[model samples]
Target chain A: MTGQVRTVDGRVAGRRGQETRQKLLDCLREMLSTSPYRDVKVIDVARMAGTSPATFYQYFPDVEGAVLEIAEEMAKDSDTLKELVAGKSWAGKSGPTTSEELVDGFLAFWRKNDAILRVVTLGAAEGDKRFFKIRMTVLNSVAKPLAEAVKELQAKGQADKSLDPNAVSGALVSLLASAAEHQKAFTSWGVKVKDLKPNLAPLVYLGVTGKKAPK
Target chain B: MTGQVRTVDGRVAGRRGQETRQKLLDCLREMLSTSPYRDVKVIDVARMAGTSPATFYQYFPDVEGAVLEIAEEMAKDSDTLKELVAGKSWAGKSGPTTSEELVDGFLAFWRKNDAILRVVTLGAAEGDKRFFKIRMTVLNSVAKPLAEAVKELQAKGQADKSLDPNAVSGALVSLLASAAEHQKAFTSWGVKVKDLKPNLAPLVYLGVTGKKAPK
Candidate 1:
């Protein structure tokens, strides 16, 4: 369980302290969305929040630490992604519907938190374990249940037994993440924005069902 | 036709100038691999190359500009990825072979240029048009040909005609790119490094051929 939110000095945060910490976090989020992560300094974040760098450090260790806090908040929100896949039926007409909803929900979540997710991705790529764990939390929110669904279907011989459920689910989730991350790339490919969900849903259904979606 | 390489000052570079410029780029590439892109400065690159910041600016405008140069060179090298899909047969046993080779070659290319590609991905995500264009040049090197292969298969009644070839091909390539970019994610999922190609090749084959890969 998450213990009480505390300051860098290990003091429990009161209501006022919490409010100020939240304010700094909001401003930091704004800066991350507008500028490259590399240019985001503690001083700039403090200036944006109308606070001194000393105050900023009173709450968090550094820019990466503050960013991790934001990422942790996003990962908590990512639990909402669970409903998109958990207990979803992948049978007959219902499979394609489940796929469509999952695609829409996933893409929307990504677009909402893209800036922070971008930094998380970069940090993970840079061999940062904290970022990697945070990213896995988000990805696993959907991937874990999705893999179970695949395993269930394969056991019933509804899906391809040859495919590894974890890899299939992981690849499908990665495909969704990639599509969400690079929606612009699809546009340049002449795949319209309106075409993304329609196009991606069937692929997800195919990956899950090992057959074309019900027409 | 290709144009001659020139310095930032609008002067054609002689052999020595080109060598110096090339050295700076090489050093920049090294710097990028070792450090975060945002922290990569002209001074550091010049120091690494045993040159001056003036010489660095003499050939490029800024860190991003120099990164673009390295990316462009890598894009040129991406031309080799075209052969992985161009005119490749996707019928029966050959389909899985093509898939394996494509996965292998794509993963190799991504690993070789992982550092700069990471920056390019971040820039494109940040809506930098120059980086987006450069990223497309590399993706299109593979995506375009793979799209054509899918179209051919769909035309011949081999693949699911209901699916959009461009979208399907784009998704598969994105999956590969994602897999390459985050190979660590798979490892953390208990997927071994050696397990990647075997697992991904079938998915690629399935996406293109719309059938279970022939064993």
Candidate 2:
């Protein structure tokens, strides 16, 4: 279980203090989604939350700190993504279906948390270790298990033996992450929004099983 | 032709003026590489460029404007990426060679311009149309021709007919982009830096040709 929620000044938050803290986080989340990260400020977040900047600072050190908190929460929720691959069958017709569900599940998780995820991605790309670790947690939620699946199939001679399961699964997950992040790019390329899943799922199936999805 | 280089105030930049503008941009580029985009300021860029904020404004309306300029320059440079796939042979053993070269070329371009591309990606993800368009120009530089190659292979019965050429190529390019952006992530996954190309090239080959890369 998570330890007690504490203010930056080291005071434990009571129920009322916790509600205020959550409200500040929710408001900061909205601010991030609507405005550029560079433009998001503590005063603005405090204003939106109907609290003082002093109160905002009491609970969090800064905007980036609060965003990391939000990212950490989302990373925790990302644990559910494990089910999209864990103990799942990748046999026969089940393979393509598994890929589709994984794609759907992953994309949905990304879309839901895109605002904070964007900041985390930017932070990680900028070489912030905390954000990088959080990103890994989310990606590995699916990737680690998916890589295991690839290894299992390869062991059984159901997949290509030459491929590195970690690389294949990592590439597949990276592909999914990129596709989810830039879905609009596909639209401009003449692929429909609905066409994405149908196309991506097969590629995932192919990448994992090293065979074209059965028609 | 790129037409006349002009200042934000609508004055044409002469040779000397262009040099100053370029210096400012170069300095801003350095600032972006070393600092967080959110924390990068016009004043800091101006200071680093040994110029006044007013002079910096003479060349660019703002930091984002200058960044867009840098991204535009990189987009123009992206034309070279087309050669990686434009007229390359993807037949038999040549298929894997083409894939490896494409991976190498694309990754090199990304690594060289990772700083600017990071801002562009963040801007695009945040729904900025200008940044999105530039990112597209860079990506489409490869995705378009790669798709055409896939189409040709599909037509010749060398690739899976059921898969969409555009989708397959787009996904592959997306994978490369993601992989390039997060090469560090792959390294952390027990994948060595040297292992990326050998691993990714085959995935590209597999995705495009619908078969494992021939040993």
Candidate 3:
């Protein structure tokens, strides 16, 4: 478990202090959703949280630091994604279903945290080590177990043996992440929102099983 | 054809004016690769270009506007990506070669323009319509022809009929784009940089043809 929350000045946050800190974080998260990342400011966050800038500073050194905190929390929550693949059947009818659930679950998680994720992704692509690590953590939550599943399928002679299991899983996860991030792009390409999962799940099935999804 | 280049105030730029504008843009592009997008300033870009902020403003309204100019240029260049898939054969050994070349060409394009694409991607993700449009133009350059290829395969009874051609091509293009943008993520997952194309090419082949790549 994470140890006691502390202020920027290094004081351990008491119960009331933790509540205020959480409130500030919640407000910052809300502001990020509505405004461009570059325009978000501490004073606005402080005003929204019914606190002073000094209080905001006590909990976070800056906006980026606070954003990192939210990203870290989201990365931790991504652990649940493992269930979408781990110990799940990728055989026959069960295979396509697993792919569907994985796509649905992954897309839902992305939609829920998209605003924060936009910043995290931008930071990582900009070569920020901290954001890069947080992103890898999130992607690896599913990629690791998915790779194992691909390896199992290959061992059983059910999947392509020539492909690198890690690469296949990594590409699939990257595909899911990209599709989730830019769902609008698909819309403009004439693929409706409802059609996204149906299309994506089959590709996942194809990638993992090296066969078309069963009719 | 696109019309002559004009300044922010609607003046058609003469030869000397165009040279200055191009220099400013080149300097800004260099600055973007070195600095965070949020931290990039007009004064610095102008300073780097050996000009004043007034000269910078003559060509572009602001930093973001200049970025849009660069992104637009890149989007135009992306038209070359269409050749990567247009009229390409997707049968037998030719199919895997096509996939390899497409992946190679796409990744190389992305790596060369990664800095601008990162900002364009971030801006689009944040719901900016202009950036969204530019990003679409770039992706469509490849996705359109790629979708046509998938449709052709499906028509020939080579790919799955249950799948949507547009969706499959969109997803595959999304996968390549994501993988290209986040190659570092794969490296951390234990997939070598050199291994990315070999691993990705087969997935593309499998997705489009609905069969394993031929050895």
Candidate 4:
């Protein structure tokens, strides 16, 4: 049975290896809730997960590799996002986007995973190399749909056709990212997230639409 | 004199108090350059500064307070930033903002001070209440001139007159604050700060002129 398991390093394999891997990932997720990747200690994490340090070493070279793997797995499950965007395709393909549709999607995305994002983004900002790489991977995932909308509008001649879609995509990405930040701040100050949409909606709407929100 | 220097707590304020404070700031800043703010510890900072725990306790009520003071003080100095945006004022008014002027000031400012800004802004998302506050104060200070610029544009009717200068100001503030943040990551990657203006100038210019830079 022990021979059946292949060790990435000189550790036991198979079911035992799988268990150790899950244990490390679970411990990592908990730390991700409250701290960035670099700040977490491998020994502390292993101990918390009830694994030995040697066991942890067998699966992951370090904390960053563990986190990057977990985050990538989580982001791969985009059913919720797909469901949200699917119902609202922004006018079957044209003209300025309604403020409600664009703004509401952004607000909902933040509320769903504020803690996870705050942690992952902070980890990526530092030189947690693997974590940083996946962080951009997740960003590009979000940017994909946004790029589609920009392209859709350009095809219909409503969006700025000549603008670099990449640049506009970056602006939209940064805007929503900041909105997530502002929402968190508002929540901290006891203001509700729902309340912020009214203030934040029009800024993005106008920037993208090049006009006022329709009543 | 000692009484005057003492904090509200019973800790004595003397030459030692000042030295302890300076040491913490210096150590924290150095650590933050190579590491994220959330990853740094008060003990690590105190140890590097060669100060005892008792000495650190005598100065700051907590680590956050010490870090806040350093970043806040950095924000207060306008010589560098003033020079950065000074002649770069809105386009219609006159002279093209010299690449030399813009690049020099931006390079000088970040090359010298990015450590603190990185700590202050990046730490905000980590739920550090002190860094969050310092981030806001630093942002507000940077936003002042941009606010003045928006008002000037609105007055000229070059930009949207109906745009709430305050909201536009807030949006603009968030933009640069976010830029400064990405700038830190860019700097860490060996990208030159002087080279950043080629990318940045167009963003600011697009923002003021209501025209996206030619793709």
DockQ scores for all the models shown? 0.72, 0.87, 0.89, 0.22
Docking class of 2: high
Worst 10 residues of 1 chain B by lDDT: B206-215
Q: What's each prediction's clash count?
A: 0, 0, 0, 0
lDDT of 1 by residue, B1-215 (tens): 77998888899999999999999999999999998776788898999999999999999988888889889888899999999999889987788899999999999999999999999999999899988998999999999999999999888998889878889889999999999999999887777878888888888887888777766
In model 3, state the lDDT of residue B158.
85
lDDT of 3 by residue, B87-199 (tens): 99999889999999999999999999999999999999999999999999999999999999988988899888888999999999999999999999999989999999999
- How does candidate 4 score on lDDT? 0.59
On lDDT, the leading prediction is 3
Measured against the true structure, the TM-scores of the candidates, in listed sequence, are 0.95, 0.98, 0.97, 0.68
Which portions of model 3 miss their true places by more than 4 Å?
none
The CAPRI classification for model 3 reads as high
Tens-digit lDDT track for model 2 on A1-215? Answer: 78999999898999999999999999999999999998998999999999999999999988889999999999999999999999998999898899999999999999999889999999999999999999999999999999999999999999998879999999999999999998999998999988999989988998999888886
**Chain A TM-score, prediction 2:** 0.97
Give the lDDT of residue B56 in candidate 4.
74
Worst 10 residues of 2 chain B by lDDT: B206-215
A192-214, model 3: which lDDT tens digit per residue? 99999999998898899988777
Q: Select the stronger candidate by DockQ from 1 and 4.
A: 1
**DockQ-derived CAPRI band for the predicted complex in model 1:** medium
The value of fnat for model 4 is: 0.15
Q: How well is candidate 1 docked (DockQ)?
A: 0.72
C-alpha lDDT values of all predictions: 0.91, 0.93, 0.94, 0.59
Cα lDDT tens digits, model 1, A87-205, are 89998888899999999999999999999999999999888899999999999999999999999999998988877888888889999999999999999899998899998998888
Q: Write down the lDDT that model 3 would get.
A: 0.94
Model 4 lDDT tens row, B1-215? 22354653765567867766777778877888877666677788889998776667667776667777777777667434644544455653331353234434544565577667665655677667766776655555444565567678778877766545555555544555454455434443334555455544444454444554443
Best by DockQ: 3
